[model samples]
Target: MPMPGKYSLQPALITVADQIGFLKQFFSNCFRKGFEWTEFFRQAYNVGYRSTGIIALTGFILGFVLTLQSEPTMKQFGATSMISGMVSISVMREIGPVIVALICAGKISSSIGAELGSMNVTEQIDAMEVSGANPMQYLVVTRILACTIMIPLLTIFADVIALLGGFTATNLGGAMNPWLYFYKATTALEFADVIPSFIKTILFGFTIGFVGCYKGFHSNRGTESVGIAANSAVVTASVWIIIIDAIVVQFTNMFVYA
Candidate 1:
């Protein structure tokens, strides 16, 4: 007979296997016929357009605060003018993508989880199946694809706004010409810095969609489970964002730098 401790490990292993199966199914469904273009466009607008304000605000604040905090240290070394370049690299290569991804994980993941969980609980998803409507194709495929496409675009927008905020913060200390500040900022960044960050955001978006959909789709049938699904989606998605960031950074350093 297995020990009690060994029995406990069985469930965890089974859960991991089940999740892997779920992901495989999701990807297979994503490539099926009868793609919903109208729904995809609507979801894209919902994820990208509705999210612009919060992303912009977060980027602006991050840029402003990062510039202010780093300025004093640069001043100690009498290299305060390098702040523009430093902020640009930091925002573009690391801070902007990670922070925006975390924000999206929190907001978008929870939203998807709760929405799907509610539909699951109310039997709306089942009803669609009964009526010969493909819920997975219409619902899950559209949402996951939307997140995959929109988050990167949103990240680019955030990078631009963050640079603007950095410029404003730099001006607060002294008069720096906008053109010069932008030029320094632009020069500091290259494709090596950009391509990896962009790739990571795509992973982040996919992780968010997968976690949210998995949690909600598998949630227990109860009103309380809806909340649990949303909460778990956010928590799991955030953890994944960190893990993916670390892995991407490691690969980038190994290959891109080497």
Candidate 2:
């Protein structure tokens, strides 16, 4: 006889173990024979190019609003001249990567999960296996790799857009030269600030793709499970993004900042 509470964690433990195994398989297949370069490029286009509009819009709004909100506080301290630097550092170091990753976790993760889940439900994956096609290599590996590559690029794009937005917002308050604003923003950032954030975005992208693929690939055999998989993928990926961001920030503080 065992307490119900004792067994309550069993499901979670099993899920963790299963996910670890899946991750191991992914790494194993990632570098194996017959890499799908064409599929990888296609997925990269879908992941990166297709996402530009939304990322641009979000980044602009984020920078504009952040500048507007911080103006009053900076004025209070008489540090108004440092607004561009503040916005740039905040966006480049923290806000830009994290926010963009969360947005992608919602958009890209759900999209991948639903697409794969639908395939799983319709037995398309099974059919591929029957036809002796390497579906995992063609599908999962390409998608995950695309995400890993594109996400950092997207984050960099967002950071530029955000700085532009900040410049716009700053000009709205008073006249400022574009070159001067950009110069301040660029000078405020160092290699330490940019590289860590870039690395974080890469991890964020991999986590988003990995969670989405794992959930969809393991979804139960039903149409309803497709929805469940997509929803779960978004939630899980978002949670992991936050967790990874926190861990990275701690390590960065310890090693980089220190």
TM-score, one value per model: 0.96, 0.96
Candidate 1 residue 133 Cα shift, in angstroms, is 1.7
Predicted candidate 2 versus true structure: per-residue lDDT over 25-66, tens digit per residue: 888889899999999999999999999999999999988999
Whole-model lDDT per candidate:
0.91, 0.94
Model 2, C-alpha of 236: deviation from truth (Å): 0.2
Task: Per model, state how many residue pairs clash.
Answer: 0, 0
TM-score of 2: 0.96
- Top candidate (lDDT): 2
lDDT of 1: 0.91
Name the regions of candidate 2 deviating beyond 4 angstroms. 1-7
